[model samples]
Target: MTWKKLDQIRRENPVTDEEEYGQAYAEASLAFELARLVYGLRTQAGLTQTELARRMGTTQSSVARWESGGSLPTIDLLDRLGRAVDVRLELVASHHDPTSSKDSPSCAVAFGAR
Candidate 1:
């Protein structure tokens, strides 16, 4: 029984079927990124999960779920969150060469405190 670093294991056994796992990976990555963004906004605004949820007209569990990456929020929810935190949300989309190794088109969501 030996210890192995997670990154080492991943490097040794990379995903061979991109067609199967690519979409899931991209979705998970986006969820994680959005979770971090939500958490950051809440903390930066000096609000607790309950407080933020109240401001967003949602429940604290919903905020916790968002922060934990358990669910992906919709644009309408994002807009409400931005309003609650006094930040501006900008969603940008860009196309990339399909022939490239990338799995899909690039999209970014920017949050700026107002």
Candidate 2:
């Protein structure tokens, strides 16, 4: 579909009709993305939800909830997941200055090996 058409549809969507709905929609989108990522990684590793939960020292239900987009994982839990799945997790931060044209400072925190 064309960008214009997509934008029009988005504008007409009920989720965007109000401020609270917009916020909830945004949150749900993030949750879905996170769920997809977690589920994909677990599948790629040939691990079941229970197995992944055991690796993460969490419960199967917790893993199921996360994979179902019913809950969000904490940063520490994300780090643990990265290690359990042999992946790297990084938290990057950039400080932008409106007055300055130069690039802003940034920080990155990585979990697991390269």
Candidate 3:
């Protein structure tokens, strides 16, 4: 489905209708984004999931799961992926006060490939 359609559906029947569901949806979206990044980087480097997995000392299935957004890698695995793909993942966390709408907590991930 198109993103617009998905968004319209979300507006009508949001997966995040509740606070807990919202949190879960956010986490899942993050996972999917991470998976897409991994797939893109791997392909850009001309490596198959199996080759990338071998470089990371894991199995192709594990890499597939990561790319499929079915599972998340550990911090250690993330580090390995960064190294293997010659990319850097920098995360910055900014604190926010509950009363300040402009200063809400935020996360920034910078992806730089060397």
Candidate 3, 1-114: lDDT as tens digits: 999998998789856458889788899998998899789989999999999999889999999999999999877888788888888976557765667665454877664444
Q: Pick the candidate with the highest lDDT.
A: 1
Residue lDDT tens for model 1, 42-101: 999999999999999999999999999999888888988999999998887767666765
Query: TM per model?
Result: 0.75, 0.70, 0.69
Local distance difference test, per candidate?
A: 0.88, 0.84, 0.84
RMSD of each: 5.2, 5.0, 5.0
Top candidate, metric TM-score: 1
Clashing residue pairs in candidate 1, if any? none
Provide backbone clash counts, one per model.
0, 0, 0
Q: Model 3, which residues run further than 4 Å from truth?
A: 1-17, 96-114
lDDT of 1: 0.88
TM-score of 2: 0.70
* Model 1 alpha-carbon miss at residue 40, Å: 0.4
